[model samples]
Target: MATLRIGIIMHGVTGRMGMNQHLIRSIVEIRKQGGVTLANGDRLLPDPILVGRNAERIAALARQYGIERWSVDLDKALANPDDTVFFDAATTQARPALLKRAVQAGKHIYCEKPVATNLAEALDLYRAARAAGVKHGVVQDKLWLPGLRKLQLLNDAGFFGQVLSVRGEFGYWVFEGDLQPTQRPSWNYRSEDGGGIILDMLCHWRYVLDNVFGKVRSVSCLGATHIPQRWDEQGKPYRATADDAAYATFELENGVIVQLNSSWCVRVRRDDLVTFQVDGTHGSAVAGLTDCWTQSRVNTPKPVWNPDVRQTHDFFDDWVKVPDTTVYDNAFKVQWELFLRHVAGEGEFRWNLLEGAKGVQLVELGLQSWKERRWLDVPELTGREGA
Candidate 1:
């Protein structure tokens, strides 16, 4: 079997998403599994060079993971022909510039979501990548989640005869970093860092909608800063400049409606940090980060309309648990394998940069809708030209 020693120039490997999702879960796990086997019985191994501005952090990560290569210089790393891929999980503001540089260096591109903070920048990045004729992708990991996969299966099987609506509850209370340090970065609450709930989760929601319910045609949103301030990692006070919560309603091309509530300040009382409930004419299903269950109308007995009588039957007891037919890995790891396969030309990669641009468009429209307090129409992604 042939071995593909793929050199990966991974930027922002020190950050939360970079470390946990890209480095540890995806790359390291793949290495531990004796590399990914190609369809033709070949094997592909990732030779990652960790790139970052911080020397100490880079060295620490390299030692921690037994990674041989580490570099503080991105430009020098990009010049290496061995590094055929450029992966970024940098701050939203840094993504466009880094990706542009990667394209000019003739590297395949992969990056974290909200590809850019705005629609124009996102579109330009897509356009640039298209012109470069490079294989590019944005991490759309939620689609590969086990619970969501079950939902997709049910949807595909037509269990939901006519889709009616989708309701999503996403979030958990992040620490204020005052007495205790926050779980997320302080920049997430700062606008200057390209941090906002709408910009972040709307990207996930866009793909979830397109893949499961239908294509989103328009949206109306209300964004808010529920918490006015937070403390930084150094225990310094910082003013919250970004919206922490976003309430958005989407109208799909198929006429199905979706309501999503995303927030960082909200308290969690559900099964997981993220939960999606989908209701249709024939059945209803609710999926969380770890579990998915469905209720069919056949099991739901008809009830008489009575104002004086007490309800007898238990509605919640009727839901059946979705069977786990296949072994599922962590969300990011699943996507990593898929991307690796696609890059090797074993299969087609559908989640390209244009789909990422559409996500940015949804967030842009969301912000506009919030500002004007009106519904906004989302434009179609009719290839590179329309985007």
Candidate 2:
């Protein structure tokens, strides 16, 4: 009967991902749709105040998005009693302190992945939010991806009997800013600036593995800075102190082995920039960002691997495409609506700060496994003693 307006403080949305995905695609689209419809037939509208260190950039973004509220001072923004939610998509090193400040300000928290640089900090952030008695969530956008959703459906339907392993190839060449401008921020290749493929992507693998297929039990990873020299945004040359490539092997609890290669130096040769091939006893499927192809045991083609003779196998023809029977929305926007509903007492939100901390734990173990040159077991995480 009445509109439920939720005030949200949106910080660090002046950057690429913050500006594109979170601001324009998710929040703006939500506002365009006239807000999220609640279970009781009421709509929950988000009133966002954009905040950033760059006043000019922030103001430009606000005006472009038709948002009236904008601020450069985070403290002043947090002081607004009307705003109950704080969302951050900023640099990894700055996320903890910002989220902590928001928690202290009695604002609910939602943030991007790798919650902190390390496991302890991530857990502490979760603890701070818990102590403040504020609702919290993390961005686990891949769960709703259309291709992965199809994989989930097939897995749920027992389409792949006795799953064996998953192999993921994710990457495309990012320019070094010499001849071609770099697509990623220069900070992404600097370790001191919270840069590295392992730190950046392992958290994603942690959740995707646990939620989609099975819980990861152990990890073996090797990191490399394939491109040592890179140019920054200003075209200044600098030594890349971070690993641009990560070769990780994860053993899931169900005995499924997952090998994922994440790199910024490799060329794209697959169906998509990122693809996951799931092989099982009865069937197999390969999924990209938007499409998934499956090949049943009955339909699989027989190929002879003979170096002596050139055989025309037509290797890619055996698999059939998966249809989208259900309509899908933007992954980030879908999660946003779910979190907003959870904050408004719709239901339990499972992907909280604690879940996010688990991702950080995986990152820690992944780096340790690489450093020690051995597989490290992932110990089960629990809440702080006696809560």
Clashes of each: 0, 0
lDDT of 1 by residue, 145-233 (tens): 98899999999999988999999999999989886889999899999988888899999999999987899999999999999989998
Q: Which runs in model 2 stand beyond 4 Å of their true positions? A: 385-387
TM-score of each: 0.96, 0.98
Query: Candidate 2, residues 290-383: lDDT per residue as tens digits?
Result: 9999999999887767999877678798899999998999999999999999989898889999999889899899899889999999989885
lDDT of each: 0.90, 0.93
Which candidate ranks first by lDDT, i.e. highest? 2
Error of 2 at 43 (Å): 0.3
Pairs of colliding residues, candidate 2? none
TM-score result, candidate 1? 0.96
Alpha carbon lDDT at 269, candidate 1: 92
Q: Quote the positional error of residue 328 for candidate 2 in Å.
A: 1.4
